[model samples]
Target: MQITQLPSDQRPREKLLQQGPQALSDAELLAIFFRTGIAGMNAIELAETTLSTHQSLQQLFNASLGDFCQVKGLGEAKYVQLQAVLELSKRFLQESCQRNTVFNSPEHVRHYLSLELKSRQQEVFMVLFLDNQNRLIHQDILFYGTINSASVYPREVVKAVLRHNAAAVIFAHNHPSGVAEPSEADKIITRKLISALALIDVPVLDHLIVADVSVISFAERGLI
Candidate 1:
């Protein structure tokens, strides 16, 4: 059936106006972008066919310009429009990252880093920089791989703090073995970092060991 022939209240556009965008199904939302139908299909039918072919909206969004254009009814204009929206979403994520401050609680740090580093095969270290009020200013990746005394430089940590003008810092590293326990090397490095940053007046707040889905705080264990 043509969109114009559909009952006004039953139409996707009408339902969107009456109930809000969230009320629409995935196909209905995509139908709005499609706007028109081919010779034998309505816009909603074309949208359903496209969604069925792609299997998921995520797959559709990830499709390349050429891939999208390969869809019978999706031309260059529609492909570019979809690509622009996807790029805008990515830009918004980057902007959100810049606005986020360092988290204070050990649990919060674990939660934040878990999404970023939990699945990595190699060790990764991140430094959380905080202001005088203990609010997060920024975070930086200091080192990667099996973190050793030789790899993690106190000078680099100090430089990062100075660059961000941070008042305090938290050290975090992931254990690829799925064990959150700190190693002997971990303790030695924490001690050395705490002592080195002390000379520059930037207190080391905590040293965290992150594993698959757990985190251990050195400060909570009185190790730092």
Candidate 2:
């Protein structure tokens, strides 16, 4: 059935306005973003088909331009819009992290890092340089590696911290395998970085391991 033929409250836009965006299913949300559908399918149906093909919103968002446009009702225009939306979300989260003390809101830190790193096809080591107040001063992706490992140099990390004049630091890296567990190598490296930064009187506050679905904290697990 056509979306217009559905009850007013049942339509994606009306449902969003009446109840809130969270009240809508993924398909409903995508339908609103899509605006229109192909000749035979309605917007909701098209969204459902797209989601089914991709398996999940994460997979869809992570798809390359070519891969995304291969969907029947989707094209380059939709792909560009989708990338813009994702970039906006990342920037919004970064702004939030900058405005507040990240240690005070660990979830925000996790969320920001997740968005930054989770979808990456390779391992990326990121450093979040924080002031004494724990507010974010700067962030940079210091190293990029293959699917499983990144070569992180403590000297380079220290140089970055010094360059930013950071008082403290939070280390985060992503595993493309979607397992949040910190490997023995991860532990060894965290210890090395902590020791390296300690000499400069810059404490390593926490180390986070980001996977596709979750973020794990070394400090929380007594690993740091």
lDDT winner: 2
The ten-residue window of minimal lDDT in model 2 covers: 65-74
Which runs in model 1 stand beyond 4 Å of their true positions?
1-104, 146-150
Cα lDDT tens digits for candidate 2, 84-128: 999999999899999988999898899889889989889999999
Q: How many clashes in candidate 1?
A: 1
Compare the candidates by TM-score and give the number of the best one. Answer: 2
Per-prediction TM-score: 0.55, 0.97
lDDT of 1 by residue, 73-174 (tens): 888899889878766754554344335544434445666666555555678888988888766677778887663322688888888899999898888888
Instruction: Show pairs that collide, candidate 1.
Output: 102-136
Stretches of candidate 2 exceeding 4 Å from the true structure: none
Q: Report lDDT per candidate.
A: 0.78, 0.94
Clashes of each: 1, 0
**RMSD, model 1, all Cα superposed?**
6.9
